[model samples]
Target: MKLTLRTVGVFTLCLLLTACSLPRGAGIEQEITAGANDADADFAMYPVTRDFLPTLAEWPVVGEPELNWITASAGARTQIINPGDVVAITIWDSNDNSLLAAPGQRAVNLEEMRVAANGTIFMPYIGDTRISGLTPQAARARLQSELEAIVPSAQVQLAMAAGMHSSVDLVGGVNAPGTYPMPDQSYSVLSLISQGGGVSGALRNPQIRLMRHGQLYGTSIARLYSEPHLDTRLVGGDRVIVEEDRRYFLSLGAAGIQDQHAFPQDVVTALDAMSIIGGVSSSRADPEGILILREYPASALRTGQRGPRQERVVFTLDLTTSDGLFSARNFRIQSGDLVLATESPVSSVQTVFSLFGSAFGLVNAVTN
Candidate 1:
């Protein structure tokens, strides 16, 4: 028993000493100031800082793709009369001499007159009157003036009969995806999404896309909710799309949870991201070895940089200090980031000693 105790004690002492000189895992710390001797480790290493965090956040988040817009007007174009639209014009003569009257009819029914390509609808006595750019009320006034020459006391009433051309499309990832008509010319983007029973899954992170005239604009649902003004009005023939955000980052190594996690919010800071994934494993992780691996466009690093630029960049944080804590809080976590919590050398040394101590205890018991 004394021999076993001595062997275990000496083995543990040696491991504790080796802990100081133990090797570290892959990170920016090693190569940040490395000489030309290190060739394989090629990447720009950035230490987390108050000023640098904002620059990292400046890294652009992707927007939706482009599409064609029928209403090319800025800031959610208002609906207007278009060709192929159907309008109903009713004509009433103040007296029995209504120019629009049929045999024994008291009024003339110009039902469902399709607007011709020339942007006008035909009226009974007044041939073709342009109404494509005019509202229903405006069109009525236009017809009344034209017929005043023939039927000086003619009253004209106009209203749209067909709505197939003036509607918003609810497409992809919506609970009730279909075509819904605009309530008025001022129907908004949010109102259209709400009409489809809201978005699927968490409304916070779902992508919202607005496509018009081959031009595409989009943002996260959370962003749209935060900035109410960004939820611009919708026009006829505009398509509003709500879809799931597929952006995610991987947590590996000594993290408490090793998995791929999609960001819950539109903007996720590094500190919050770490907490969401259960943080680093207290026993196995090196607090000073927290590393974030990212890829940047080669052109981004080429500007104002002295050395040859590389696409792969490594950002290291030493959470053991107060400066790092604040820096991490402000640092933004980009999509597709690989967050790695490296193993501590002390823990590795402790593991070896633990196994040896167990073997020694077993041998001592057997000998007895």
Candidate 2:
């Protein structure tokens, strides 16, 4: 092919267009903005309708005392009993002269016994007995009846010497992060978090989740703490993970201000995010060139990795439209998201000034 001015001009134009394209960081901003606008419009057109609505006139701001009392009392306690729990059993006889006249009374210490696969325990005098589903009091009654058959008029007592002990693991954004012993085992999620010394100062509403066999179990910390009944018991093999809060976006480049800001956990409108970045700088920020770029985990882009699959969806955002720009906040920020702001065309003025300074330096060097 023969080279010509027309072809050269076209090639130059293409290069200029490519250069004008936003940088990698700016792509994330555009994606977020677009997503926000789309979500906002969807929400506006179809305002959400719920099953019940509270009336301010009827309900007091502080709530009713009776209602509050009911709510507090309604919170049920959860018992987390497991195998390998150290339990003490006491036996007494009123008419049996042999047991009553014995010089010394000895207490049998059955240090925590592992729950057998069949869920039965073999005690000293009692043959294979099922105590898995029975409460401490019930188990004692059963033991007394069985022993009375052998020796009439026998009294029995059964109690847990020490509460159940289970290993609960804690990590991330905590002062003291490690496995904790949940002994007086109750279903209080907050109790477990307190043992771990709570979340770090930088994180807000830290996500404390309970997992078993790689599956999420139980509700969030907020819900579990507020509603005690929801604070499900921690099982023997259950794992508790405390993760750092990562639900915020970073706005950089030519925006009015450049900084990382947090978004609401539930739902954030695009207008909310724009306000956080100081509402865009008119002098240095490009109104037409706003972009949003999202990076995906490399493993996510690949096929068939072991464990859970990661979704790496990247999109764009244009702030030119009044409604579209305001919708940016509606797009939620996923963990590890990077948001960037693009500079206006006038930013090149600084480069020109730098070039002039370089030329002046060269002249001085040549003269010297």
Candidate 3:
């Protein structure tokens, strides 16, 4: 029994010696050390302070333009027409043998005419009459006046046919993506998406991007639905694209679950993100040592910023304190950020003693 006890003591001593001999990685102090070699320092470590909170808050806001779907859908349809449109004319002549009327015919069907480059069309009596920019009703009134003298008591009816000139495209991530024509100018963004069969349910975090007049604008469909005004109006030559959102952040160290998670909404606070991964491990996490690793552009750093003049940045917080808890509630989490909850020092000591207890118990069992 005495020899077995001595053996267990020797085994425990060896574990302590081995643990102390391992090399330690650089800490927050090394990152903030001034006059240090840039080759040795990889990033800047910042303590969570009231002054530094604004920097993190600015990261998640990308400044998006708001588009009102209600205003876009409520407007009266425009009467302006464009090229490549077909027009049909009908005339009721009182007598036959006229240039536009046939023999013994009370009504004459005029040949369909396509508008030319000058937005004009030719007729029997009227020469080069422009009708491209006018509506069917307006064009009929204008043309009737031109033929009143030549064909007395002649009534005119006009119909304009729509072409592919007024269409919006639905591209990618949709169940039935295609070009949908807007015969009526009251087509809203949601109306176009509904026609394209809407976004696919298989896609995670689908985004709706609109390209209009050579400029690209976009937002999440979930967001667009939440805010009715964001649905906007879709005009001709507008391209709507639906795709999966790729923005994400990583959780590491003593977190309850270590994995990469995508942003669920347009804005997410640091406190909200901790709730997302089930919070930190209760037994192993050090509540006072919550650290957020991030990288920012050097150009974005303010003149009086307390960090290095480089892009790499780190932010540390102590959740045990009231200040940290409130600041974290307001601090925003940006994409590609790394949220780490450090392991408690007491847990490390407890683990070492646990191994010693196991060794001693095994030796006693063998001796008995």
Among the numbered candidates, top lDDT falls to: 1
Preferred candidate (lDDT higher): 2 or 3: 3
Residue by residue across 1-368, what tens digits does model 3's lDDT show? Answer: 35655667788888777655433222222223343345666665667766668764444332134432223345447644556566778888876566677777877776567777677888778888888777778788888999987887889987766554567789999889888767666677888888888889877788888888777787888877888876677776688888887678888877877899987776677788899878987767778778887776665554564334456666777788888888888787777888887766656577677766776787777778
lDDT of 1 by residue, 307-358 (tens): 2256777788889989999999888787888888877766766867776677
Model 2 lDDT per residue over 1-368, tens place: 34555755575555456545535333323334444435333211111112111111121211111111111122224223345544566556555353433545433345555545465667656677776655566777777788777766667676653223345666666788776655534534566677778767676655666666666643335555677766555655566666644466767776656776664442343455566678776656666555444444344332433211223333234577654554454444443344446655565454445555665565456546
Model 1: clashing residue pairs? 67-214, 67-215, 68-212, 68-213, 68-214, 69-212, 69-213, 69-214
Q: Which residue segments of model 1 deviate by more than 4 Å?
A: 1-40, 54-80, 93-99, 161-165, 201-204, 305-308, 359-368
In terms of lDDT, model 1 sits at 0.72
Q: Candidate 1, residue 93: CA error in Å? A: 4.1
Instruction: Give the Cα error of residue 330 in candidate 1, in Å.
Output: 1.2
Question: What lDDT does candidate 1 reach at residue 111?
Answer: 83
Overall local distance difference test of candidate 2: 0.51
Per-model C-alpha lDDT, please? 0.72, 0.51, 0.72
